[model samples]
Target: MSERVMPGHTDGLITLGAADALWVDLTTDSAVPTASGAFTSSPAQARMGYVLLGGHAVATVRAGDGRWSVSEGEVRRAAAALNAVGMDRQDLVRIGPFRGAPRQECDEEAPLRWRRRITGELGGPERAARREVGRPYHLAGIDWRQILVEQTRDGTHRTWWLPRAVVRLLDAAEHAETQARDAGDRQTTNPEGPTATPRPYNKELEGQLYSVLSRKPGTSRRVAGWACAVCRGAPATVLDHCHEHGYVRAPLCQSCNTLERPDHLYSNDIRVANRYTRLFHTDTDDWLRHWHRCPGCRARTTLPLPHLAAWTAHIACRSLRPTHRAPRGRKPCGVLRVSWTGSQNAPRSGLLTVAVDCCPSGEHRVLAQVPYREAAERFRIWLAETAPALAAAAGPDPLDGLPAQSRPVIADTSGEGLALF
Candidate 1:
C-alpha cells in the first residue's frame, strides 16, 4: 500500500530545559541553535527532554517544571489519530503525559449512555456488526454495518480501539449513508410512486415492474389504464405477477401488490376468523374475486377495527368448534354483521345480525337482531370496557415462534371454505 499522508507541518523539534522549552521550526539547514541560558541539562533532561516530532504532535510534559499537564482535548486527538491508523492497545506507542496510566488503558469499554447511543445510531443490534477477533474477510451482501475500519500491517489482522464518542460518530455516518442510498434507489425505482411513511411503497416490486415494462412498450400503456384488480379502486401502481406460473396476472395497488401472499393470508385468515378476504385474479376474463368494499369507492376492503377482530374471533371460534380450528366452511360463527336495509338517505335504516352455526349442516341460528346504530354504540362501549378484560384470554397463536416456512398449513376440508366474493 501507499504511505498515509498526515496533516499539518512535520518538521518541528522540541528542546526542553530546566526553566523553559524551545520550539524551533527548521526553516533552513544553516540555521544553528546558539547555546542559551539553562540550555545544558542533566542526564534526566537529555533522556526525556528532547522530542523530535511532527508539528501536529504536542509534548504533554511541561517545559517549565516537567510536570504532566495533559489536556482532555489533546488526549482525545491522540485517541482519534490512533483509531485512524487502526492501532490497538499493543500498538499504542504513548498517549498524553501519563506514560504509566494503567487505568486509562483498562478503560476501553464504553459507558452505558454511549453504548445506547451507538446502538440507536446503527439502527439497533440487528444492523450492528459483532466485533470479534477472526481472520480478515470481505463484507457479504447487505452487510456493510461493520463501520469500524481496520488496517493490517506485516500480514496480521489490525484492529482499532477507539473512544466511545468517536465510534458513535462513525456509526451515525454509516446510518446516514445507508439512508441516502435507500432514498436514491427509491427515486430511481419509482419517482412518482407513493411515499414510504403513512403508505409504504415497495421499491423492489416497482423496480421489477419497470424492468418488465421496458421489455414490452405497449403493455405498459394497457396496464396503466387498469385499476387495482384486488382493491378495484386505487390506481394500479404495480404489475402483480404469479411466481408459480411466471406470468403477469394483473395490476394491483401498492398495498395489495406488496401484502398479498397466499401463505401469509391463510395464516391471517385462521387467526382473524376469515374476516378479511384476499382477492386473486387468474385471467383477464376470469370472474374477479371480491372482498368487503367501501360503498363510495369500493377500495377499502381490509379488516376494519382489528382490535375488535381478535377478541371476536377468539370467542366465535371457541363457541363454534371448541378448538382453535374453525368448522369446515370457515364461516365465522357468533360474529356481528352489519347490513343496510333502506335507501341511502336520511330515512335509511340498518340492522345488526348476530348468528352462530356449529354443525356441518348449512343452518345458522340467529341469536339477536338489533338496529345497527344502537348496536354500533353498544359495540363501541364493549370495545372500550370489555375488550381489555378479554385481551389476555385471546392469548398467542400456537405457531407464534415457528418460522413461516415451517408452519403447517391448515387445509380447508370444505370446498366452500375460500370466499370468491
Candidate 2:
C-alpha cells in the first residue's frame, strides 16, 4: 500500500490509523539546560509518569517543568503505535499550542476546563442557570486525546489542537470574551447616531393581550394548555411576540417574558421548548427528561413529552427508527418560515420566522405563523380524544422504568425578580 501525504504538508507524515489519538512522551534537549533523563522508554511503571489509555500510550507531562520535548523518531513511534490501534488522522485540526492560560492565582494542579454559563436571551427557556463545565462532559465528539508535539521553535515550529480539555476551555473563554465585547458595544453605541430606539414591547404586548382577550380570555388556547416553556413549571399566561412586526412567537408565562428584557427571544431557547411542545420533542424535559440512545442507529435524543405519551406510543408502535431503518415515519418533513411583513400587514404582536433544512432531500418550505396557544391547545384536544388507549397500550409512564439518577427536573423560576434574560 502507498502512503498518503497530508495535502499542503509534504514534510509531515500521516499515520495509517489510531482508534483515537494518544499522548506520549519522548525525550529532547531542553533550551533551559536544567533537566536530565536517559531511559529508553523504561518498563511500564504502574505509577509511572504515563500509562496506556484504553490500548494507547499517554504521557503524564506535568505543567511548568522538565524536558517536555521528544524526538522525531519517538514521534513516529507514537504515531505508529496510535495507528496500530486505529485512530484516524483525518479527524484532526491544527488548532493551536498548549500554553497554560494566563493566571493571577496559583492553580498549578488545576486541569484545564470550560464552564458554559448560559446568559439566556429575553424570552428564552431558562435552563437551571447552569454552568456546564467539561473535562469530557459526555456530549460525544468530546472524547479526544492530547497529542503534545515536542519540537524546537527554531523557525520550523507550528501549532495544533491542544489535546482535550484546553481546546474546549479556550473556546469557552473566547466565547465569553466575545459576549462581553458585544454587551459593551451595545451599551456604549451612540443611540441617536444610527441605532433607533426600540419600540416599547410591553405596551404593544398589553394592547395585543387586550385585543385577544376581547375575543377569548386569559391567554390563547395553545398558551393556556402548555406549561411555560421557559420555566416549565407555570402555566403559560402570555404570548411571546415580535414587538416590531407584531407577530406571535411562542407561549410563555409572564415570569419568563418579564419586561426587564426589552429585546427579542432566543432562538435556541424557543427551539428547545418547541422541540417539546411542538410535534415531537428531541430534548430532555417534561415527558422525556433525559436524552436516550436509539438502539438502531446509536444516535441519541430525548423522547417526546409525557403529555404526548399517547402520540409517543403511537410512534413506538410503528417502531420507526429512521436513523437506522426505513418505512417508519419520523418528524414531519417541512419548513416553517416566519415572515416579518410591512407594518400594515403585521399581525398583533407576532414573529414571522421560517424553519429550513427539514426534508430528506433538504427541501425548504414556508409555514404560516399561528398563535402558539392555539397550536398547543389543538394538540391537547386531540390527545384527550384518542390518547388514553394508546397511552394505556404503551404501558406505564416511561419515567417509572428509568433509574432515579437519570430523571431530570425542570428548574424553578418563581424567584422574586431577576433580569428577564
TM-score, every prediction: 0.20, 0.23
Off by over 4 Å in 2: 1-107, 115-365, 382-421
Worst 10 residues of 2 by lDDT: 289-298
Judged by whole-model lDDT over C-alpha atoms, candidate 2 comes out at 0.28
Q: After superposition, how far is residue 46 of candidate 1 from its true place, in Å?
A: 74
lDDT of 1 by residue, 1-421 (tens): 2222223422222223311222211111111111122122111122221211110122233435654322223323323332343212221111112222223211212211222332233333432443343322211000112333334437752333332223322222222222323344321212121112212222323213233654786664444345556545344545654321122445654435433322112211322322223221132112122111111111211112221223233332235432224557454433333222331122126443344435333335444444534443443444335334332222223323322321122333432222111
Off by over 4 Å in 1: 1-340, 343-348, 356-358, 382-421
Candidate no. 2 TM-score: 0.23
Q: Name the top lDDT candidate.
A: 1
lDDT tens digits, residues 1-421, model 2?
3322333432332231211221222112211111111112112221233322221222322234432322223333433433333233322223333233232221212212221111111112332222232122111112232232333345664333322232322332223222323333322212111111112222223213223543665445334445445445444545654332222344554434442231112321111122222234432222221111111000112221222222322232123212223487535443222222222112243233343325454544333333323333444444335444332323223333222332221221422111112
